[model samples]
Target: MTFAELPRMGSGRVSEARRQHFHAQVQEVVVWMRQYVRRLGFAPVARSWLYALESEGKITKGDFTWASKWLADRRKEGLIPFELVGADTTRQLTGHDNFDEEATPREYINRQLRDSLEQAAMYWPSSYWKHQTNYPILWSEKKDVLKLFKPELPDAIRRFAGKGQADVNSRLAVVQECQWAQENDLQPVILYVGDHDPSGIKISDGIAGNLRQIAKVEDWECGLDEMESDGRIVRFGLNADFINNARLLWIDGLETARDEAKGTNDLANPRHPDHGKDYVQSYLLEFGPRKCESNALIANPTAARALIRDELWRWLSYAGHKQWEAENHDASKEAAAAAEGIKRMLAMFDSAGVLYNPGLIQSLAQASLPGLPA
Candidate 1:
């Protein structure tokens, strides 16, 4: 519901009834968040939960600061588990090693051995994307997106262009990977996701131009211009339709990194420097001053994942890829069988105490190779 729909409060003293009503709303929000956390099976970032609440009409963009503090308060009060809130890895300290110990070292070794054997039996030597018609690289405008979609997309190589622009080193590395893909006769394609703001839209639209410039300056073997001509960069998310359909919340003002850093209103604001620029004017006319962040997509996790997979399957089918992987493993069945046989032999040697008898082992080695000196 919009702010206008909310119950108006008197500017004077808050009545006991009004206070109780506000408390009831906070409890409702907490209960809803708990359900959402359970659905996800893990604590996502606080903003993700906020977006979810926004989509549900339980809160608005302006409620972020107040809601965030409320959530933290509830968590501290033991109404919510601490694990129900995701931690920021950026500020985490390094060189920390803390873990639950197993019953014993031998038990750990046995468990590891069993895991190793299982993996060996199922291992495939071929690359996951070997037979695909196109080589796809997943790109996101923000690094935080990596947390939501990366786990589901194991085979796709990921590149994060933080704030929609790749630095020189990142550009060089991605281009090199694309070159390798091209050499293998695969069409290099970048499946991109970004915000639904002016800069985001412009960056998505300019991906091919940027890549073309990179390839030209680097003098790469593959013609990125010709390759990208067939709509190689696919911006498959955070569009107007998706935002409306998903019921995402939009921030009221147009704010950029510079505006944020300088603590000033800029970008599309009337008092700002570039408000009258064509790009700014066009964006303001089309999308207005409000902007939806790409992180808002995390609110609808299943649909967001489906959107990614739908684009991915255009180049490679999930069933086809799995079948190919199984076939590759089957082709190496002899290796697995040999490994099993070797495991059995080692077990027998250990049981017979032959492994501990160094002199016996030397004699056996000499017996196998008669030319060895006594």
Candidate 2:
């Protein structure tokens, strides 16, 4: 029997089995057609097949006409395949009309798939670096030196002597700067110039993280605290008064109180004699609000200058220490060294106090600041 009249081998009704066999035959034909089209490097066969199916009433004539014209046009444009018809092997077959201009179903499906894949790929994390340079004057006469900061800064701080705002502005600036650098095929190196303080350190870290996230450049560098080429460290400018206020609020009296209260105990009950819980609670309540208020007020110029000078001195000393270590020591080593150094310095301070001398504190401060003579 011919291919269409052959008996289907299966345990179903004759018509059902025949239908299944017919579907399988159609699938095989499609597979063969694909192979034939690939090997012959032609597109007219797809149009011809659609036209034949339409004539046989298996598909709509409109669809067949549209597909045929699309294939023909694409083939002419080198987007589809075509066969040479003339002796010169340059002329192509073209006589059909009533073609549809809309995208074919298969083309539409492919476009959607491609778009979905692109969107999925986009969700993957990416990073980049953004560089900035700033120079703050020392009382208005210092030459401008390069100091970098990231992402991008706000319009306020975009130029010199501009208003410095929240950490968010600095972070966003760094990110924007990094994007600009990446587009221009340059690496970012952010430099900042500011007074030293806890907030400055925190801002540096924030800018670094923000740039790293935006550019998807895990290897990219962006931060104000980065070291300069000449081995000097850069930092975000802190309000000198803010640093002083923060030191007074967070560090100063707590260390003294803890030290002085070390051996004092209630002699009443040995098991819980050292429970200075009441004193600790009182310290927290009394100092916490003042510290919070100090932080809030220092950002205001009117309140900033009134910050205690001794607290500012302590902050400057601490900041100078951090800058020195960031410039001269490896980060991991610096942490360990700093801990040891602090322990040694504190012991020296205590020793000096017992001997009624203040030279040890000065020596420790000098040691912490990088450029000070040994």
Candidate 3:
């Protein structure tokens, strides 16, 4: 409610004029903030932004949903997904164009049924852990690193975004996600890529620290002792080794080199003071106290991907890939077997009916795969 709407004093407490004046002063600030948020929202809604607003008290915890509604209104006006929250997606019936594209009705039904059966039967392997004694990989994100990687990743792996010193909520979210993975009987292996500097270095620690604290306080199923012994976290890139070897270009001044809107960074951020006991003296010695943002590594997208692939392959092998393929082939055979009776039943009905529009199904039983009776 606006300040002006507050109950007036009975007598000599505060005048109605004073109340209105106070409200006008307060509304000036609110109006400015509302305008600012509206302008920023020309872009897609983000979980990070929602969290930020809650932290800043712009949106109260009790009214957390207000920001989402505000963003949704903007999205309806036509804003593409930044992360594509499934809840905010356009809902459609089975008659949608995507269902019919390059497909016959029988084929579509057969496909839908087969897929449902596949899910129900749980024929697919859940993860690398289910396949073997192996564990899951947790990959980290930095500015546009998501844009660089290929879409496909193994079932045993998950991805997360860390803009910088991952805010408390984001950090806690990461902790919960990793903890959930551990509960599912998968060893957590965190593989991160970010700025090769103080804040980036500390972020990895910050996440672990918060996770450890929660595990202890909450008496989680997977305790800190187990996590300390079994869990593994490693920073894999933009290291001095890769920097010197790959010769990733640098921008002498990060403050000057950044185009905040574009999110383009020149790597050499001068924010952190390079100390004698910095994590890697070689990095400081070679780069001369210069910083390297995560993008510097992926600047050569081909090499960066190759590097990540090589790291993942250390955990996953060709045998693992083939194991998945073999499982898939068996599932395909099973689905085909289950669908055979339906095809025959449809084929018989077509012959019995005088006015039957026997198009593709007729062609299928009379001509398609040999399993269906002619």
Best lDDT goes to which candidate?
Answer: 1
Q: lDDT per residue, candidate 2, 20-53, as tens digits?
A: 7655654444444455444333322242345333
C-alpha TM-scores of all predictions: 0.78, 0.20, 0.52
TM-score sort, best first: 1, 3, 2
* Cα lDDT tens digits for candidate 3, 1-374: 42222121235678778867655554443444454344433222243344334434455434435656655554463432323322322243346455355357767755666576555444554344555433544446453454444433564466666666556566566566656666776555667776666456666655566566655555663644565566466677767678666665443433322354444342333323333334435444555545656655433555667667776666655686778678776876676666676566655765765224556556755664666665
Displacement of the residue 163 alpha carbon in candidate 2, Å: 17
Segments of candidate 2 deviating more than 4 angstroms: 1-173, 179-210, 218-234, 237-374
Against the true structure, whose TM-score is highest?
1
lDDT of 1 by residue, 109-204 (tens): 566776787777766777766757777888788655666675577644556645568776677777887888888888788888999888888887
Sequence-dependent TM-score of model 2: 0.20
Superposed model 1: Cα runs more than 4 Å off:
1-35, 71-82, 96-116, 150-163, 258-263, 317-323, 329-335, 371-374
Error of 3 at 45 (Å): 16
lDDT-wise, the better of 1 and 2 is 1
